[model samples]
Target: MAPRPNVVLVVMDTARACETVHERYDYLSELNRLAQTGTEYTKAVASAPWTLPSHASLFTGTYPSKHGAHAGHKHLDEGIPTLAKAFQDGGYETVAVSNNTWISEEFGFARGFDTLYKTWQYVQADIDLGKIARTKQGTEMIHALATRLAEGNPVINAANAIYGQFFRKRTDDGANRTNKWIREWLANRNDDEPFFCFVNYLEPHLEYRPPKSIAERFLPNDVTYGEAMSVPQDAWGYIAGTVDLTDRQLGILRALYRAELAYLDRCLGELRRHLEAAGEFDDTVFVVTGDHGENIGDHGLMDHQYSLHETLLHVPLVVHGPRFETGQVDDLVQLTDLAPTLLDAADIDAPELRDASQGRSFHPEAEIPPREHAIAEYMAPQPSMDALRERVGTSTDNIERFDRSLRAIRTDDEKLIRGSDGTQEFYELRNDPEEATNLATERSERVDTLETMLDEWLDTFERADTSGEVSMTDATEARLEDLGYLQ
Candidate 1:
């Protein structure tokens, strides 16, 4: 039998299908080119909001519950069969290059891959782009910024510029690292073996900053942005906990996001050139997708971490390769499906044990069935120990019992979000993609249907043994902070 093709799967952090070259970004020339030669999924859903659990499912073809790595900055257990490991068993080399701070060799993310690497450490010093933005004319802008700071004038303008540039540059750097890793790995390839490689980019995630050149490329000519337009809006709901952003702030925040998209596109161009030159572009089975999406004021939320609204659940998933069809797949597909899809792409059978898996692989021409909805789960930020005790209405001794949790079941037209203590959120995604409406009480009939579905799915949910507590070591926390995670 002919050898299976090498598979290259790229997951762009927080990059939604709506903003990619094939979907919403009209000016994405590079993305357009890639799509011409690839299949793009118009609507791809994420298994979870954050990195650890999301990638865990993507690699194992299992849910976070099954793998037990449900929180951010936590290690995935080495016992699971990562996609790379499956490929390795089939005599294929496996490699994973990631820019995610929490997903590193220090954590169990490095298991099974022959080559696993983390990108350059992003630091406070990289905020210089924001500094440059404040200084309109080099020395003069610098002087103005210093004077404002020294005179206690808020230096808000300087901060804005710095913020804008920081996110932009950081995402650009992420794309660059992806290309660097792919090329370096490919150069040392053993011709007889197939390989499964994962390139994780941190673009379009948070601390939104895009490169200067890339930013101007996407800005609206009509608006004049100010220094206040730097940080994206703080999350909604926990109103007091969020940073209220002004209109100017939103504009600059959007520019930073667009700039990151541009950077991802640019890096993709370089990657394409390299692969095509090496005669691997057409022969490889490549997947361009995101683990989850950002909430840029969608449903009044700023970023991910809160709510399973479409803004967070709806991610982009595109599959293009020799056997896959070029048309889009409208079926509701989750990150869990990736593991099986990839295994199928490589002509490898999922382990018999995986038959109990919740996801199924997609065939190139097979018709995908309609799903009732997609699922999203979160371990909401915990309340203080005192608050937990109060909420549990029990003794403070078992503070461990209260782990503020939330889960969602999102359909094409509606969503049902359930929180601890039976709190619920309902939105008709068709009419309100922003999920501004909560129909849990008002639309009781529909809620019942979804609630039943949620229960059934949960019944089947094989909760991973995370024990519902996550605390990274200080060293690991440092890495996560560098990746813009909340420390």
Candidate 2:
């Protein structure tokens, strides 16, 4: 019998569909080329708007409520089954390389893989320094001597700290390191087991500083690199109405984000070439998708929080392999369904995954029922209001406005967003693609129907038993802060 095909899941963190799709950017030639040989889902929606919960839904074939990872809770319930665990149990070698701190082993995202590399650790100079400054007396003596050299001068000490934190870290978001490690691992593995590799590229997430060589090609004529670098990375301040960005700042941010997307496309092309060179291209199932999208001045928001509009929900999903047919699928699909589809491809049967998941298979050969509507949930504010207040150094009137939770359901034509604070928003997606108009008050009957459908879906939610605390290192906290997650 032929060996089972390998599976590779690549997540483009915070990539929005409006910009990354083939129709939008000419710089995404690699991604567009890959789509020609695979199926691209143009209407794929995320289960949540942010990272942790959206990823939890991606790992498990369940929604955020079922997985119990959101703003209210940071830990994914340990009892839930993960896709990596299922593949490992099915005899495939599982490995993961992630640049995001939230997807690290500390958060239970590494439970299923044989080896999960936190690429951020490799980029930090202090982690490398720790190797030479071990606990032994010889190492301690060297560390003490180095510390004493810059001990007295406050300016020197500040400069050293800045260098250790920012100047020494990789600005590419570890994509280069991730590819190098994957190629090395593929070359060294002697076993013939089909491998499951999960990779995440975070270059487009925030602080969108693409490499200068690539950024120059995508920047607008009026935007300068200095202007892009000067744009505030503080989404919280902007959302709270405490800080207002000038039009010039917004333009700089948009240009830099597009540059990052172009860079990501180049990385994807490099990865595919590596797989082909390793003699595993044709036998590998490649799944390229985004966890959720960012809000770049959409709905007056700078980050992906406090809203469930199309800008945050709509994402790009492309599947390529021996099992998937090559074409475009406009069907409404959820990211949660990917787990079942992959498991079906590998012929692995895990009752836990099936029983726990709310998703259906989209495999061409599978006889699954059609989806009527797509659902997305957003729990109360992430980087909580208190955290926002601390970051901006004062309270604003808009703080209370975003404290409520949100749930949205969308059909092919219309969408309804309901908030826990009794607010409702309705949009006709075909006519108002930008979601600029609200018909909640104008069309009462249609709003009621969508609300009822949303209610029925909410009733099926069985909240997972997620009761635990997260313990993170100081470096991890600092990295998260740099990403604008923490204050």
Best-fitting candidate, scored by TM-score: 2
What overall lDDT goes with each candidate model?
A: 0.67, 0.82
- Candidate 1, residues 1-487, lDDT tens digits: the string is 7668989888888886556635446667776666666776665788877777788778787776677776532667767677777788878888887767656765577777887765543332221223334225768866755654443234444453455445534435567766866787677677677778788888777765566667776677754433424454333222233246666566667677877877777787788787777778777888888888876665555666645666666787777778876566576778887777777778886484257457766656435565656787775442334443343354532333334677888776778888786788888877876666677789998888888998898898667656644655443454444444443
Q: List the pairs of residues colliding in candidate 2.
A: none
* Alpha-carbon shift of residue 211 in model 1 (angstroms): 1.5
lDDT of 1: 0.67
Instruction: Give TM per candidate.
Output: 0.81, 0.91
Candidate 2 matches the true fold with a TM-score of 0.91
In model 1, where is the ten-residue run with the lowest total lDDT? Answer: 122-131
Q: Tell me the TM-score of model 1.
A: 0.81
Instruction: Quote the lDDT for 66 in model 2.
Output: 81
Error of 2 at 55 (Å): 0.5
